[model samples]
Target: MKLTKIALLLSAATLLPNLASAGTLEQVVKKGALNCGVSTGIPGFSATDSKGAWEGLDVDFCRSVAAAVFADADAVKFIPLTAKERFTALQSGEIDVLARSSTWTSSRDTSLGLNFTGVNYYDGQGFLVNKKLGVSSAKELNGATFCIQAGTTTELNLTDYFKANGMEYKAVTYDTSGQTIDGFKKGRCDAVTSDASQLYGLKLKMDDPNSVMVLPEIISKEPLGPVVRQGDDDWFNIVRWTLYASLEAEELGVTQANVDMQLKSENPSIKRLLGTTGTAGKDLGLKADWAYNIIKKVGNYSESFDKHVGKDSPLGIDRGLNKLWTQGGLMYSMPIR
Candidate 1:
């Protein structure tokens, strides 16, 4: 009898961690908000506005998850993190989801105890230099000193690119993107290197934006997206599908303004996506209207992109690789069915 009792206790103890990890959704629901990790401030990605509310593409992704769970896009507490701090915060459970402009790399996926949901943005590492440098191409910047964000793939890509090109350069690393830009502005380095999207965002922060220009060379592929802890498949699915729901909504011609009208869509894919039919929400431990809420509250991926980083916004970035698959770009969603 004592042996059986000891075995039972051991089994229960073994299950405890899984049980705790599985309750992330429940914990967020009880807490009344989802804890979302974002960058300190990346314009058109994640940043506080004049009203002190977080707004940007990555910010909208967090709102989509909140809308899925609570039907409230505003039920999110955004925690701003520097480059080196983002992953540690997620690993420590300081944030439920991380939506900073983080690249999805094999090392990060296998070693960080985290899982990237999917690529929300396709990016590449590039250089930003003062127009006065008279260098229109990255090749001209050989032996230049660069201000780079520490603890990012940007740093590694910079090293590899320079080495492979038989060029030598120096890197002055900063703890955050803001500091890197500041370092560049202060003339601490000849150029700043980061994901091209970020270089654009950083350029906008300059006293005179036109004084700097992003080099035409894209040296590395950066598939940036949201991330969640690895042990909880339930929460993982919730985050992953929330992203897919937005992409699917866009593919099906659903928008925040038109999601309500889409309820009557007879098309099977549209119906499944809008929660007019199917068990997608139930499979993910959510209400049938969960996706409907996300669409109605957060808008589709296109809407968020356009509003935050595309032509409608200050960034005015073109939807090159970020365009929907049907439109000849890489953004594609799995079938909701």
Candidate 2:
């Protein structure tokens, strides 16, 4: 289900506009829309609603940056991309930032001309299969046909996981998660391979979720996060810290519901994070209330996660490895100052 070559060519053409002489922050401001690259569809992380408007965890990342820069979360134009096209789109300057669920990897770091801002989702690859297949473990799927998204580590990881486990499986590669899931549901693949968090999102979207079982084998490390072109250190810092601010806000006990009250906190960390203690935002070329705009408008990471992908949502994914370092998870925010 890879996007046809023609589509990629068209994407390239669309992205061929002369790169602005200024940094990405200026381009975003001038264009009046923070062009964002997002997944084709992954419930709770990035998905289109019934009304065709995008909303999810990843979507909020883009919105938070928009809010910090433009003081409005809604000033974003999302470009939905297949995994195959996402890196190319970003590399070609088609989008100011990519809020897609992309796993950070060494090759991507050097070859893609992109910078992973930070790990928004600490994850590992996993398997999902029809319960009727009676597959208890990944080791048992020696002859399985794995449906995987192409141009992603998931594809190579699928091959590597099976090889490392001393098993053999064929792979049916797709550019989009929707195509992979649809193929899997139609019995075209024995298993669907992707990040575990994504497995949770896709499983909930399946027709017979109860019958679709995600295996317990946690395969490769997959730290899904945002990415941007490799240039303009200042612009990169703005994007990087915007993500950190959300995590820091959560760590410092700031939330959308309490941001207004937390502004006057005596705690130095809280004060700095909320723009009450210094001109940190100005140093980043953003308004003094840049972080405040994010927290007050977009909420903290925990708040967004709970609303979009937590216990109450249909995806219902446990925070697990994505929880803050204070909670014993890998999530750790950098100091704002």
Candidate 3:
């Protein structure tokens, strides 16, 4: 019996760390608000208006998670972070989830003690230059001074792309996207390099947005997504499914305005996603209507995209690779059931 007790004790001890790791949901519930990390400012991604209200694609995502948990999208407290500060804020528990436009790379996923929920945006590195530079292609950028944000995948990609082409350019690094754009505007650099999606967003911030143009060269693949700290499967599921729910909603023709009617959907996939016929949310330690709340309050992925960064928005970006997998794009969700 002594041996039996020892074996049981060892088993219990082995489970303790996992139990502790899964406590993020409980802590968030007790706190009554979800702390979401986002970019300091990036138009159409994460940015503050003149009235200090935050609204953007990333901000909407943070709100979506809050809606899934609290059924109140406004229950999120947005914590603005820079590229250098984003991971540390998540690691130190200063934020419950990092919804910033963070890239999912091997090192960031494994070496940083973080887990990327999934890619929300598929981007590629590109360059932005003033129209007067007569640079229609990135190849024309040889010997140009490029303004770039420090501590980003864009930095390394820029270096790699230039060297691969046997081209030479000087880099003027800034700590923030705003500063990078400012440096470019002030003629501190001849061009600015970043993700193509970001280059579109940043252009809107320029005094003469029409005067700037993103070149036709894309250098690197950047799968941008939300991130959570490692060691918490429950929290990871919550964040992951929140995004997938949005994607699935769009694919199933569910929208913020039609979610209530979708609750009565007869299609199996729609029923399962809206929680009328499955325990998808309950399995994640949330109410059965968690995904329903996200769709209704924060909208589906396409809705968020169209509103924030697509044709209807100032950014006017196409859905290209961000479209559903069925529509010749890469966005796909796991089966809800």
**lDDT by residue for model 2 (139-159), tens:** 999998988888888877877
Backbone clashes per model, in order? 0, 0, 0
In model 2, the Cα lDDT at residue 26 comes to: 76
Error of 1 at 12 (Å): 12
Full-model lDDT, candidate 3: 0.92
Best by lDDT: 1
User: What is candidate 1's lDDT per residue for 8-108, written digit by digit as tens?
Assistant: 99999866645656779988999999999999999999999999999999999999999999999999999999999999998888999999999999999
Candidate 1 wrongly placed segments (more than 4 Å): 1-20
Ranking by lDDT: 1, 3, 2
Which residue window of length 10 is worst by lDDT in model 1?
Answer: 14-23
lDDT of 3 by residue, 40-77 (tens): 89989999989999998899999999999999999999
The order by descending TM-score is: 1, 3, 2
Computed on alpha carbons, the lDDT of every model, listed in order, comes to: 0.92, 0.87, 0.92
Error in Å for residue 80 of model 3 = 0.5
TM-score of each: 0.94, 0.92, 0.94
Could you report the Cα RMSD, in angstroms, for every candidate shown? 3.3, 7.0, 3.9
True-structure Cα RMSD, model 1: 3.3
